[model samples]
Target: MTQTPSSSGREGGRSLKTRVKTARKRSLSSTLWLARQLNDPYVARAKREGLRSRAAYKLIEIDERWHFLKPGQRVVDLGAAPGGWSQVAARAVGAEAGRGRVLGIDLLEMEPLPGVEFKVMDFLEAEAPRQLMEWLGGKADVVLSDMAANATGHKKTDHLRIIGLVELAADFACEVLAEGGSFLAKVIQGGTEHELLARLKREFAVVRHVKPQASRADSAELYVLATGFRGAPGA
Candidate 1:
């Protein structure tokens, strides 16, 4: 089991270690979840690497393979809870050098990060894209979305929910991406909607679907990487 450096109990008003100890003495589910977290190699690696969440490595691995991120680029991160992907993006785009910027948004509140600007709001609302555009200050070089709808356990329904999120993210990307910009978003294994894929094919020079190694084998999630954007109709 791996343990990271932890701040004092007073920091968050109560210690997670104490809560975990109490939960271990009571609930089976809590114990199992904690055990999994402790044993997860990515979790341990993230702690050692100073990453906010294990999910950061997934994006890093994907970008390593695809070579999408570039220095001096502007990026938009959707569903950026816990600031993991934002951290990775900030580093890749050279935020420290003042040549890059990242704007992130999510429905859940995120802890502060050095280079990320995050907002808490439901992205499905109409005004969300407007706000993202305003923050971006112009078109973005890349739009990345790791958004997933809360699962309802019905396989078909859950698939639709995730696809909906992907579609919305794609639509917003089309609106704000500069020519030759890229869009990366999560989708299910069953594949994307035909209409959506058709649209992407028409708009992007290359549209490839990939499943990163860091994504769990049993999970249905995959990512769609679309590059070389063509301006949308009437844009």
Candidate 2:
């Protein structure tokens, strides 16, 4: 009797071959993307340190400069697919932080990670924040959203979509953040809506936008950071 290849094994091999062929078909662009990934110090460092994604470095760098995360703080991460930012928050808050927690939510499926809670749901839905608060048991110390809408190749439309998402995230943050808490959300380069900025300025003691070094230079995405929440409109 001869051993035979399993059906799963055969299918896996076929899939691998298809991927190789696809890579070959787009060799130029694929090569550039691969080269950039290979040469990225953050990529190398993430692999060496066993982090989930290179995007982790963005949060790490931001925290390093701003000192937003603390040992026993509660955090909420929106658009946390691939678990990079969640991983960083978990480590910073520690397992025994005592009521300190991190909640990560995304529309896409994500792999399970220890020390952080994850939900597969869209934050834009009205019930999502209520569910998250139930899990958190209280208001968060920081709410961070890196959500970006899929670009449609129309610059104005894309910018407007991103701003809409940012505005929603800000509103959600104002509802869930404790007094003196912080909110950070990704925005586009054309500047945020005047109404939104005005609201932030009135509610927070400090509000500013920053473009992290980890962000691509040509990218229009920036981050709006607001601190010292003064309670939502009616509180």
Candidate 3:
């Protein structure tokens, strides 16, 4: 689903802390999450700016510095839900203006956006790459993944799961991205594993970890950006 750009970031205001009272049915963790959502500046900003989620700012900050998403480029957003990144990508690539295209895929259903084509398909499916390419109508200029596995509350397990997802996303990107394309995915603080990092370095001219200010300082989440993709063999 393509999303139209919302109002510019010019409108802004400070937010007051909001405390959530724990109900008899609400767990402490849920209560804390609610409170955090209520107090988060990015959350308020997203609401004010008519954006999908606070995660949108993370992409905005990263792209502002890196300048990867460009006009008339096709972009694919893996695991896009609530379409925050898709929204940003559509605007950056001018999809809404008909200059570019944006395709988003996820297992969960997403509400339609103005400049996005969305599909409900699990990225883990074996035919996913083929299907996504068919939907996109060609190779992608950029592939983005903000997917995360459900937290198991075990640091090691969580880290491994996220790395696994990133590895899969990287593999998909390699299959679908055009020459000189780019791939961006979320990873934990430990960063990509040696094998994956080495492969990415070989496939793309530049590979680095990027932390956007919009991301929570206390969160371990980090984005791995790989740019200048070398063409796939026999492509």
TM-score of structure candidate 2: 0.82
**Candidate that beats the other on lDDT, 1 or 2, i.e. the better one:** 1
Where model 3 places Cα greater than 4 Å from the true spot, the runs are 1-15
RMSD of each: 7.1, 10.3, 4.3
Residue-level lDDT tens digits of model 2 in 1-235: 1111112223444532222223546777676667666556566667867789877777777777777888888899999888888888888878334446888888888888777888888777888777777888888889988888898989989989988888899888988888999988888887546777888999898988777776766678778889899876676
TM-score result, candidate 1: 0.84
Using TM-score as the measure, the top candidate is: 3
Tens-digit lDDT string for candidate 1 (1-32): 12322323245575344234535366877676
Residue 72 lDDT in candidate 2: 82
Which 10 consecutive positions of candidate 2 have the poorest summed lDDT? Answer: 1-10
- Give the whole-model CA lDDT for all candidates, comma-separated: 0.81, 0.78, 0.89
Please list all clashing residue pairs in model 2, or write none if there are none: none
Residue 103 shift from truth in candidate 3, angstroms? 0.3
Q: After superposition, how far is residue 186 of candidate 1 from its true place, in Å?
A: 1.1
Clashing pairs in 3: 1-116, 1-117, 1-118, 2-113, 2-114, 2-115, 2-116
The sequence of per-residue lDDT tens digits that candidate 3 reaches over residues 4-79 is 2243334456444677999999999999999988777788778978789899998998898889999999999999
